[model samples]
Every structure is written in structure tokens, then in C-alpha cells.
Target: MSHPLVIAYHLVWTVYGSWLPNDPRGSGSRTVRFDPLADLGDIHLGRKRVQPPRREVREFYDHAADLLKHPVLDLDKAARAIVGAALGEVVAAERYTCYACAVMPDHVHLLVRKHRHTAEEMVTTLAAASRAGLVEAGCRDPAHPTWTAGVGWRGFLEHPEDVRRTIGYIERNPLSLRLPVQRWPFVVPYDDWPLHAGHSPNSPYVKRLRAAGRYP
Candidate 1:
């Protein structure tokens, strides 16, 4: 028998305009302007390569890690509302069934079913609309970039077991890490998390999984 057609997608929603500075080696420049952290002074008397300043190095690494870890949205109540509304629109347009969703200060995690959209396409739509939504929600600050360039993680699930594992990982990921924690903000709490809208929560796909006794 031919294998069934099933696909799963796990996407991460990063904070708006909160990307960390990276090494510029690939940007045509041979070196970074001034990495205080990496620039350790040498032993002047001996002109020897002494141990670099640990504190500076540590600070720089810590700072960069924090920045790249997650985004922190500094939106007021009204702005959040707008962002939420806009996100709803994007989700609807994409036709993804969100199993679990968490909105963190700096990022988001969405356990959604793969629709007619690709991971890249979903991210593009979300990033664009979310930014516009922020502005619509009254964040008119020209300095704010609205969103980072792309998503952090986009996992494609090909098996029933993988889907179960991915969902568990996404839900507990926040507790497993530090701040910019994502909170369950918009998962369809009552529909058993179907893949498509209007499909019976117990669609044929799900039945087949159960029949196979592999519905993780």
C-alpha cells in the first residue's frame, strides 16, 4: 500500500525588531569595528599574548546570547490588542490549524498544521502583517523595525510520532528556557487541534492514525 500523505509544521515566531548583532566576517568586512569583548589587551611589558580579559569576553557573549535568545515586545495594552487581531487575520488567511501558540515578549511558538502554505510563506505573511498590525495598533515609532527577518525554527514533521514529540517540545520549551517566555495565547483550546478548519476534529487522517495505533 502507498504511504499516507501527512505533513506537520512547527514554526517559531520571533520578536519584532530584536535581532542580535552578528560577526561581520561574511559582510565583506574582514573584521568587526570594535568588539570590546573579543579585544583583549596583550601584556605590554612582555608583548605576550596573555589571557584575554575574561569579564569583557563574558559580558559580550552574555549580551549577545540574551539578544539572540528571544525578543521582548514593549507594547502597551492597546498595541497588543492590535497585534493580536492582526495575527488572527494572518492565521486565518494561511489556513493553518494552530494546536498550540504562545506569544512571548521576544518570540512566539506555533504548533500548527501545514496547510497549502510553506514555512517560508507563512513566516513572510506573519512578519509582514504583524508589523502592520503593530503600527495599526498605534506603534508609530519609526525606529521600531516591527519584526526580525525570518523565523528561528521551522520543523517539518513527516510521521505521527514526530508530530506528538514536536508538540510536546513546543509546549514545554518555554519552561525549559529563560525569559521572553512564550505563553499559550491563541491555540484552539476546544477543537482537538484539527489540521484544517471545518474538518471534523476526528478527521479520516486521525482515524487512520488511531487504526494504526500510532497516533502519538
Candidate 2:
């Protein structure tokens, strides 16, 4: 059987399709270019601008990540509830071992166990559910886009040491080797962890990658 994996995927999208060049604000008018670090050869997977994005676009992206706070308790209850509930369901249905989750206004952070599904499936389900939930809650307006275009990252778990690293990043302070397992593992990388890769838990590659700070 294929070994299970620990994966963490972000809602890679930005509001108003801000990351793509096809949108009005995303057009060259903003002098935006793609991110050099993530770009592949000549193909720009994302957009950048010489000038900052228009206020509206900036506000939209900013708001998407900010509304993560409890909207109902605050002002945007419907939006917050959608994310909160959607994350809960995603965790429950997938039976993922969740590490740490933070629902940012525009996006969410889910460190979940990697199991039967692929990273693509996990992200897709989360996005769909969150969108549906928002609509049901009367927060998602048809006039505005529900999601950007894609998710942020679906980093595959690379090794035990790396898993520890990510857990820390997600702020999971495991108790004395302890804590009731949150769900599955909390954070699973794409699927390259030593254990997930069918290698000995202390495989040398894990060590090397850790030393190089590229394990994840």
C-alpha cells in the first residue's frame, strides 16, 4: 500500500483574480510582474506590478485574509462562520490529522495529515466547501468572485525532522512528547517525508535536507 502522507495546502487564491494578468487591475497598467522566485523560466505563474495594486484590489486581498477573525462576534459574522465551519468539516470528513489551523480573512492555514487523497483534492474540497458555506451564510455576493483562482501552496511533507519544523511554524507546541493528537498529524507536507516515502524514519536524505534548510 502507498504510505500515507502529511500535507498542508493553502487557499492559493487572491481576490478578484488579482494574481492573474487577465484582470483589469492585473493588466500591465499596474506594471505588475510575476514573482521571480516562483516563476519557471519564461512562464510567470503569478503576477507582480511595478506600481502597487489599485486600492480596491489591495483592499480586497487584504480583507480576504483579515476577515478570518470571528465575523459574527465581530462585524462580518457570516464570512467568519463559513471559514470556521468549512475548516471544521474539511478536517472531519478527511479524517486528517490537523496540526495547527488559523483562518485568516482572505485565506486559511491547514496543517493536516496526508491520507488517501492528493493535495489537489484537499485544496479543491476546502475551497468548494468554504465558498458554498459563504454563499449559504449570505456572505458571498455573486457580484464579487468567491475565490481567486488557485491555492497558495500544497507543500508535501518531506521528513520527520521537517515535519517538526513545520509543526513549529504552525505553532503546534507538542506536550512532553504529548498532546491528544489534534486530528491526524496537524501538518502534512506534500508527501516526501521519510516515513511517508517508504524510507527509514531516520533516512540520511532527511538529515541532509534539514541541514540545507530545504527539507520541506
Candidate 3:
């Protein structure tokens, strides 16, 4: 059966002060911010949501830029295009089957199969390729870092349903923000997975997944 993956990463620009390690929602690391919420005691309650400290919201905004190595990144059309192209090249070179991707102005979402590389390696390579592409396009500043210091968020997709849901979410993210639909040349057809109507399903990849009972 094809391994499913759903990887979501926010750019350094998007996370600046909005969602720091100190966020009351819980943090990924201590270096990002001094999370006072971590001091409040056990916040994990199974699947329940943890509320952030109301005061730290303002604190995060105050020190957002100070925490970043570069100024906030607001990608223009050219920048997004460069990153998208670079992402496609990396995917093809790595031999991972890409299902969906959304290269938002400040972040990116990807749904792919875990192939020869681990998810962490995939994301790191993608970040590096994207940075190089930005540099080539003259969109990246030489004086500052292109991406955030640490690796962005990573999650595993355990089921075909998860894969389908995640892809839909990624595809519809721009619309959810009231932005225009994101169409890019790098978005390859995901023949291995179930697609909305009108997409052909005549690939060997789809046949394998179907034989494995991974897709309907």
C-alpha cells in the first residue's frame, strides 16, 4: 500500500509573533519564546483545545519582529511562482508522489507519499530548494535567512480518509481566507488517490492503491 502523508508548514514570516513557542496553545520549543503557559501545569486533555494566556497575545505581537532573523516575508506573485517551481523539482527529484500542495504567500501545505526519504528530510530539502529558487529569482534578501530557524510542523496521515481530507483542506485554504484560488504549474495530478469528478483514474498507481484497499 502507498504510504500517505500530510505535511503542513508555516513560514517564518507567518509565525513571527502570531504563534510563538510561548503561545498559550502550547509550544513546539522553548527557543521560540518564554512560554509562561507552560508553567501553568498540565494542559493536555486528550483532544480538547488548550486556551492561550490572554495577556501573551499582546506580548507576542510586541516582540514578533525581534524574534525573527529577517523581516516578515510577504511573497509577491513572482516569489510564489519561484517557490512553487522549486517545490515541484524537489518532489520529482526525490521521487515522492505529490498529491496536493498550496504554496501560500507566507506558508505552504503538502500532501504526498513517503517515499525514499523521511518526512523531515523531505521538508528540509523542500525548504532549501525553495530558498535557492528565491535567491535565483532575486526575491530573497542576501543579508537575512530565507526560512525560519527550525523545521516547520510535520504530521503523519494514517489512513486514506485522512489523506483525502487533508488534500481538500489544502486545496481550499486560500478560499477559506477569502483569497483567490491558487493555481500553479507545479501542482501535478494525483492519479493514485481519489480525485473529484472529471479527473481520469487510469494510472497504475491508482490500481495498486485499489488492490491494497487504500482507496474506494
- Residue 39's lDDT within candidate 3 is 44
Off by over 4 Å in 2: 1-78, 171-216
Evaluate all candidate structures by whole-model CA lDDT and list the values in order. 0.56, 0.51, 0.62
Per-candidate TM-scores read 0.56, 0.51, 0.68
Q: What digit string (tens of lDDT, one per residue) describes model 1 on residues 1-216?
A: 234345667777555433222321111122333354234222122212444465754554455544342333555545555666666787776666776665555566666676887887877777678788776656745456666554556777655456677667766765654634444345554233344356564767766655666554
Candidate 3 residue runs with Cα over 4 Å from true position = 1-19, 30-59, 191-216
Q: Please, what are the lDDT tens digits per residue for candidate 3 over residues 96-126?
A: 6777787776677877765667777777888
Q: Give the TM-score of candidate 3.
A: 0.68
Candidate ranking (TM-score, best to worst): 3, 1, 2
Residue pairs in collision within model 1:
71-105, 71-106, 72-105, 72-106, 73-105
Candidate 2 lDDT score at position 58? 59
Model 1 C-alpha lDDT versus the unseen true structure: 0.56
lDDT of 2 by residue, 1-216 (tens): 223333443223333333334332333222234343122122223344454447855564444344332221211434655666776787777786665554544445566655687777777788778777777777765444566545545667644555566666544432322432333233333443344656663556555655656545
Q: Comparing candidate 1 with candidate 2, which one achieves the higher lDDT? A: 1
Best by lDDT: 3
